[model samples]
Structures are given as C-alpha cells and as structure tokens.
Target: MSPRKSVAEALSTRAAILERSVAIASAEGLEGLTIGRLAGELGMSKSGVLGHFGSKETLQLAVLDRAGEIFRAEVWEPARPAAPGLARLRVLCEAWISYLERGVFPGGCFFVAAAHEFDGRPGPVRDAVEARFDAWRGRLRKEAGRAVDAGELPGGTDPDQVAFELLGAVMALNHALQLHHDPRAPELARRTVQARLGRPAAVTGQVHRDPPEPTTAPER
Candidate 1:
C-alpha cells in the first residue's frame, strides 16, 4: 500500500478499536477490556490491537476519551445552543434524560458504569473517571449559578446542591434502567428533575435566603 493509504488504514483501525472499546467498557466495565478479547472480537491480531494503544491503561484512557466525545455530542451539544442559565440547564437535563433513555451505550451511560467500577480504585483510570465527573458537575453548577444570578432560579438555590441533585437524578435513572429495568425510569426521572428545578429551595444556612420581593409592580 502507498504510504498515504497505509496511514488511512491505520487511522481507520484505531477508530474501530476505540468504538468497540467504548461499547465493551460500557457494558462490562473498563476492567473487562483485554487486548486478546478485543482482538478476537474485532478480528484483529493481538499485536495489532496492542500496537495502537501500547498498553491496557492507555487503551482504557483512550476509551474514556472516546466516550467523553460521544457524551458531549449527545448530551452537551444539544444543550449548547439554548440560552444560558435555566434555559440551558433545562435543555441539558432533557438531553441527559434522552441520552439515558435512548441507551446511547449498550449499557446505560458509560461514565456512570465507569464511575461505579473505578470509584474505590486509585490510578490514572480512576482519576480520569473522577475528572470527568467533576467537569460534568462543574458545568451543571455553573449553569445553575447563572440561573440564580439571572433570577431564573430562586436566589436561595444552591448551585452545587442543584448540580448534585441533578446528577443524582440521572444516576438513579441509570440504576433503574440497568438494574430494575424500570420502564418508567425515564419519565420518572424527567418529573423528578422538573420538580426539583421548579421548586424553590427553602432557606437553610447563611448562604441561602429568599429573593426579596419586587418593590413595585409595573409591566404585565
């Protein structure tokens, strides 16, 4: 093959490997990934599979990266165009529900499974998983804060708490779908999310307080 063609083939093979890796990792946990297994399933030689990633850790990291890309495409990008603050947050939540409902990964969300599998472990893989979760929570928190600033969410609302609850709701959706196979899980999650966002948080500590009422009524 020409040098250009050889490079193209190599790229194609790498993409195929990562695609299969993400699917396998989603259903079986990242630890379930092995060069030999992937080689057999993809019809590639063991050496060929290992040649792309060099080691299992590298392969796992690559799979996490690939899964992240898919997640952004499915869950984040759809919400990107919405108005920032509550509008964007609402869109993000809706997309998140759809992502889980559609079963984007053969096993629910890839990060959810990876999070459970790697939570107790310590290493690059575990760090990668944690980092992804942190970033996701940060995004949620950021939008929630903006909503509060924009007077969309109650001033009393805690963005971090909102982020936590939102993440928890979707995580529960994953659990219900994966473990109990609950058919109402998606809609149930939607209702839970909507209710959580719709209800104003009660005043708690020093940081939370009710928004002051408008001094004068003018516009309709």
Candidate 2:
C-alpha cells in the first residue's frame, strides 16, 4: 500500500485543492469543475484529484466549505467591527451585495449556482449547502435583534422576516446582475432595507428631535 499522508500535510493539500476548486467553479460553474480540469489546472494527475476527494460529491462538499470560509472573510468578519444593530444589519446587507458585485465567482455567486443545481437533489451536497444557509440566516437574525435593541428599527421588527427579505433582495439582485451586469437591483435592495430599519432615534423615553434650523450668515 502507498504510504499514508501525514495529517498536517493532508489538511494543507486539501485546503489548497478546495481553494483551487472554487476558482474553477467560479470561472466555469460547478459543473465545469471536473477532475480532468482540476488536474490540469493544478498540475496533478486525475489520480491525485481522487486522492483528495474520492468522488465528485465529496469534492463538491469540500468546495462549499471553502467557499463559506471565503464568504466569511469577505463579508461576515468585516461586519464584526461595526457596532451591532440596524447599522450592522444595514452594513451586512450592503456588504453581501458588494461581495456579489465584486464577483468572487467569475460565473457569479457560488451559493447562487449551487442552490439552483442542488435545489431538488437530496444528498450530502444539499445538506452541506443548507448548513451554510442556516449560519447566514442566523447571523442576519442576530444582527436584526441588535437593530431592535438600539431602536434603530421598529420594536416589532421580526428578525427572521427582516433577514429573509434582505436575503431575497440579494438573490433578486444576483440574478439581475448575472443577466445584465447592472448593480442597481441589489443596491436598491440594500437601500430599501436600510430605509426600512435604519434611522436616527430618540432615546428610549425622550421626545423626537426636530429638524435642525438653517444657519444664516450676517455678512458676506
């Protein structure tokens, strides 16, 4: 039997391969990322591709995981420094659109492509994708909760509903952008979300502030 790869080495190689797989998927859609293409791109044999992932399904799952990591780095982690609340929620909504606009996937968003590909399929690939969905939705809800706490949004704002709307808007823009290379659809979505939930608020028990008076110059 061939010698076993060390744990550390195996992990490192897997990471590299997963990263490369995403780049291929981003360029050619997940369907385009075949063992042959990956092998050629990575300068490895088809057998080597099989070594990291014994099957295409397994490779798909690994790609999703690595893609999630990329998403976190590009969007989620950056939002952490923003104070939690409607502002954070607003920032997150914009950030997601920006990520799509930035074109992490040359083909468009990976999650968007995978969701359509696996919509009706029941398997580890779908399961893995759903796991990431749950995480994203959860983050939205948590961010919404902060908005409500800070009075940036209506006290009655439903975090789940808010998150859903935001996510749906992103999807709408994603399709629009993919079709026409226009950015407005998603930007509109983000603006709508912020307009709905974000604003300067009076203190919990204080009266609303009036508009500021215009300043006048006595001498020119």
Q: Which residue segments of model 1 deviate by more than 4 Å?
A: 199-220
On lDDT, the candidate that comes out on top is 1
Give the per-residue lDDT of model 2 (tens digit) for 81-168: 5666765566566777788888876767678777777768888877766666776777788778877877767788898998788777
lDDT of each: 0.84, 0.71
Top-TM-score structure, candidate number:
1
lDDT of 1 by residue, 43-129 (tens): 999999999999999999999988888888788777666666877788789988998899989998888888889899999988888
The residue-level lDDT of candidate 2 at 65 comes to 71
Q: Please list the Cα RMSD from the true structure of every candidate, rounded to 1 decimal place.
A: 10.3, 11.8
Candidate 1: residue 93 Cα off by (Å): 0.3
lDDT score, residue 107, model 1?
91
lDDT of 1 at 10: 98
Q: Count the backbone clashes (under 3 Å) in each candidate.
A: 0, 1
Off by over 4 Å in 2: 1-13, 199-220
